[model samples]
Target: ASSSSPKMVKAIRVHELGGPEVLKWEDVDIGEPNEGQIRVRNKAIGLNFIDVYFRKGVYKASSFPFTPGMEAVGVVTAVGPGLTGRQVGDLVAYAGQPMGSYAEEQILPANKVVPVPSSVDPVVAASVLLKGMTAQFLLRRCFKVEPGHTILVHAAAGGVGSLLCQWANVLGATVIGTVSTKEKAAQAKEDGCHHVILYTEEDFVARVNELTSGNGVEVVYDSVGKDTFQGSLECLKLRGYMVSFGQSSGTPDPVPLSALAPKSLFLTRPTLMQYVVTRDELLEAAGEVFANIASGVLKVRVNHTYPLSEAAQAHADIESRKTSGSVVLVP
Candidate 1:
């Protein structure tokens, strides 16, 4: 169908929130872009843990029958009036709100989309846009990781964790990554982890203490949430920061202010939407991610890919922790 023509596109829609079984592959109508929007024929879509959060009702949806995805790379096929700096045929990638990228074609806000560098692959851009940008803000903004700074990262082989490990290492910080399996430990080590602690075999807090000679790390990036929340705080140095970004296993329990009293620690649960609220902010973060990838400093491992129709399976794999690195849905 032509970009301007109203037509049906294959998309994954959730009529109700539940398991992977709830994601239904069906035809959805696509219309011409409205003002300040552009139609994108998606080349690749990123699968993330946040998608699972929405699917399982941990994160509420604004409405029913929603398409749940936050990142995708595609070529702009149509541009609406009042939109500038974006035109048809431009390769672009976007990661943030409104949640509708799990499709072959989607309409995206002009301000939210960023141009993907020609040197970077679309699939790689799709895979890393959200996860890499999270690492960008976590290491650069949340806490500037510097030389001699030791940090702990849970789920080191994960899409976001691997990027965090590599980026933190690049910033000259010592990275202590925690993984559930020996295989993941090895992979985490290769991804620039200075110390890989297999949490399945050992207590990460004890290992972090031993590795630092009774002292703890400067920051602990804990995405595994419920299972690692308390231990993550224990792995931190006095006055350290705990960056809880996701809940792969489950949402963390309510933490009281007294929990931070012992170590005088800092806890923050940041989201990408808040960080990239402005257009300039979106471009700046995305530019850094792309530049790092193009320069070979940041390697995006698209270790798994499924067709757009198989998004349910992709979500299942991610929830099960059966996949590592980045997973993408190819259109």
Candidate 2:
């Protein structure tokens, strides 16, 4: 097809925010790229818990009848006028912004797209773009994990958690992870966690303290919120950093200043959008993620996949906590 060709593409549209049932598989007319935008035929789309937030109305929709995806791997089929340095047929993967990747094809700003290395599979690229880049920013920028630093990661078998465990382990950090079940505990261990705590079976704060010889961890990378927030704070050493990035369980309540006064701890709630605001930052973080994958330092485990039309079932599985590692929607 030519860059100017208009076609009907299968897309998952949300007419009303609710459960997975709200995701309607329908055909949408897609036209040529507008100014500063490029049209891509997506090969695969990444599934994150944040997608559920958008679908369930936890996160407000910018408009009605919107496509709900933020990360995908695809090839540029059309380049809008005035967009330079990007040619048609180039493979690209992108994460963050514009919120319309849940389709066979999508229009995205050229600047937001990052080149996908040929050595990496499109499915893997799609799986990792958002989650891997998130781990990149969390470990590198947020707390700056180093050799011998002990850290605790919640939901260790999750999309971002699995990547964080492996990356931190590679950086020589002593990785301790918390999971809900024994099965997930095994997966977390395989992902380079030095110690896996079954939060369902035991007290994680005690285990984290036990694992570190009562010293506690230098940082706590907590994605499971509410249920684990105070426990996460307890696992931290005095003046330790607590990076609260997501709320899978539920949002935590307001924190009083006195909450941190005991340990004089540092607390941060960071988002991927804030970390990769500029084009350079996006490229830099993405470059490292792709490089690590290419070199085998970062292994992307896409454990689950579904056709684009089955996005609803996929969402249900993720929300139920039945899926682990990364999940992708093949278009």
Candidate 3:
């Protein structure tokens, strides 16, 4: 594939961190790998709010200039030393890392990638890898949403939220999701949310209490952070799990551990990387995602697709919540 292509490729890299404007679409030379790596000619990129955190300088693990996409689907062009199973021209996809996406070609660790099934399209692979694994870790690994258990999820129309609804629905849990608007509420219902709360017009804490007949829920997945933190806590049943995964509405303030005393709630903020730390774990978790996708129980919503050059606009849409479900960047 590298022999078939030219020199420089257009990439979305950040020159500075502030807003979507920092994501500049410019020509960047795709480099060959040293060893234990491969150059992937990316065809599709996944747009996530975590990218917004990187762009906003809130999550400052990055240097000045870097491509900020965690997941993509592409054909391998150059394979490095010691890797035999993944060869050139092999189709693959990956998530769970950062600082190297939004470009035409990205060199990544060979072990980090998984083979793309011929049954799945490149775009679907890209869209599901990161967020699907996230859902996999959340319900399947983190707390294990079982049948007859009820759960509350914030930002129910967002990327992982969409998948969580479907996955949990299949697991037979009654899912109550919280959204900011009527449209999002409706979308969440379509995604298998048993009940949707319009947070902007509804008191979510009260609604959760009312929805469960004052029993709250077994688990509360709070990704909207600070704004929903307290409400999330109050909405859980005794011994319920509060999973604070992402800070989409900005980071939550420090909470006293004693806050859990009233209900004996369990608090855990799990990340996908931790659950998939080893090659075996990565394969098993991703295999669960792929199996569900192939079985059609997991519906990945690539609600919008933006050309690589329009990533700034894509970020703007995500920041504004103008687009719901999942948004993708097509190269």
Q: For this target, which candidate reaches the highest lDDT against the unseen true structure?
A: 2
lDDT order of candidates, top first: 2, 1, 3
Instruction: List clashing residue pairs in candidate 2.
Output: none
- Candidate 1 structure lDDT: 0.91
Off by over 4 Å in 1: 1-5
Write one digit per residue (lDDT tens) for candidate 3, span 1-331: 4333445778888888787888898888766765778889998988888889888888774476787888899999888766688889999998968567889898888989999888788898888888999998899878989999999989999999999999999999999998888888888999999999999888999999998999989998889998999999999998999999999888999999999999888999888889999999999988888888888998888899999889999999998878887889988
Each candidate structure's TM-score, on Cα atoms with residue i matched to residue i, is: 0.97, 0.97, 0.96
Model 2 TM-score, all chains together:
0.97
lDDT for model 2: 0.93
- Tens-digit lDDT track of model 2 for 136-218: 99999988999999999999999999999999999999999998888898999999999999898899988887888899999
Tell me the tens digit of each residue's lDDT in model 1 across 1-331. Answer: 3346675889999999899999999999878888888889999999989999999999999999999999999999888876778889999999978799999999888888888999999999999999999999999998889999999999999999999999999999999998888888888999999999988889888989999999999999989999999999888899999999888879899999999999999999998889988888888999999999999999988999999899989988888878999999997
Candidate 3's C-alpha runs over 4 A off are 1-7
RMSD of each: 1.6, 1.7, 2.2
Q: Find the 10 residues in a row with the least total lDDT in model 3.
A: 1-10
